[model samples]
Target: MEEMECGIEKKAAAMAAAEEVGRKEEAAAGDVGLKELSRKLNDFAKARDWEQYHSPRNLLLAMIAEVGELSELFMWKGEVRKGLADWDEAEKEHLGEELADVLLYLVRLSDICGVDLGDAATRKIVKNAAKYPAPSKEGA
Candidate 1:
């Protein structure tokens, strides 16, 4: 879990730095081009001395850990976390950082496996909408 959380932070720092340099001209290359993204992921890991720590097994475990951390924000508290009620500025910032952590590991995992997350997510949303379309409020 710690490993995964660390990886996410690491990736985000690199991405933010890249943005500062005007490297990413656009949001990911859309549906067809992820080659460069994967390469960047690989290079980022290598440069940080993290490649040795990121086997498929470790990466998978880390991804799950990151998810667990995200869940911890509300696993039992339910919607309290989402409500942002009673949360101080620090807590809000912490929450934002943790959520970003989950997203980072997710994107990294997809890159490692040569998967296109944006496309995959869009496809899943379409399938899910078909399977479970909006409930009819009129039925009430």
Candidate 2:
């Protein structure tokens, strides 16, 4: 079953990669939402038959690893802004790749767990706004 799943995932990923070439046009035109990206990633995995390895735990670990790589880019840099500003094109590209990896794993994990990330994010934002309200005119 595991082998079968891996095969499926590989096929899915290949198909997704091919489709990604075409998707570049859409991506260039406008931003894609988390749900859209999630669907694309799920389709990618389904095609390759790799869902057997997309358990939440594994995905979480993969996300953590990607974060670690992203963090490494900032190591020795005093501040995030300075680090980003100082990076050349290659470094920035590397940073972007790591970030993309983290997002991909996160989206995959959320999809498998049946979480609606957009709704969850909206609720969190509303909760945060209530938790930290703007200062009143009198206070200011």
Candidate 2 segments whose C-alpha is farther than 4 A from its true place: 1-23, 26-30
* Model 2: lDDT of residue 61: 91
- Model 1 per-residue lDDT tens digits across residues 40-100: 6678888998988876677889878888877776566645744687678887787787876
Compared with the true structure, what per-residue lDDT tens digits does model 2 show for residues 49-137? 98899899999998999999989988887767755777799989998789889888888888888999889889999999999998789
Q: Where's the lowest-lDDT run of ten residues in candidate 2?
A: 24-33
Q: Give the Å shift of residue 58 in candidate 1.
A: 1.0
Task: Compute each candidate's TM-score over C-alphas.
Answer: 0.60, 0.77
By TM-score, who's the top model here?
2
Q: Going through the candidates in order, what is the number of backbone clashes in each?
A: 0, 11
TM-score of 1: 0.60
